[model samples]
Target: MKQFTISQEHISTYPNPIILKKGEEVYYGKEDTEFPNWIFCKSISTRKSGWVPKQILSTPNNSGIAKVTKDYSAHELTVNQGQTVFGIENLNEWTYCKTQNGEFGWIPSYCLSST
Candidate 1:
């Protein structure tokens, strides 16, 4: 498990929950049936997708490019927070990805989103 700092004591009581600050950009995680995740900005009306991107943005990777070489649909790795299953070329096959920095490689869509 990794350690993270909480910005507010009011929200520290929750376990394994992603914290979001206003104006911060983050990734989406698994949907919480008990509590709605991402709150839509009503100023721009849009249909709810029942998912929330984490408010805490991840540190940008300084790698090159890579590709996803396997299938993990059976793992139930939905398009949640840190779930890097989106924007792929093949949903079930290997897909190529390029890092914003410079690294290039492939990863099982499932291996992502989580650790």
Candidate 2:
């Protein structure tokens, strides 16, 4: 496994219990669905925040961006494995969003993998 760094200072400010920093990676899941697989990839940017996944409001992580509630398709959204989303808005509750290019559509929260 590769070494990664996580922060805890911003956890209290997130809409959820977790607060992801600008460049950190962390695994997010609960119970039987813990660890290894089923991870959501996330990255924090200096964009505005208003709504995200309601589920994340309670289970926030300090090292990954909160998951969104949109459906993502390669034909709809132009996202690769290592691309970062820089136009997200209203990330306090579950809200679907399209990329700046309009190629990508809403990205469901469960499909994201951080780290």
Best by lDDT: 2
lDDT of each: 0.27, 0.32
lDDT of 1 by residue, 77-107 (tens): 2122332222233233323333333323333
Q: Which one is best on TM-score?
A: 2
List, in order, the clash count of every candidate structure.
22, 30
**Distance from true location, Cα of 2 in model 1, Å:** 25
lDDT, candidate 1, residue 88? 37
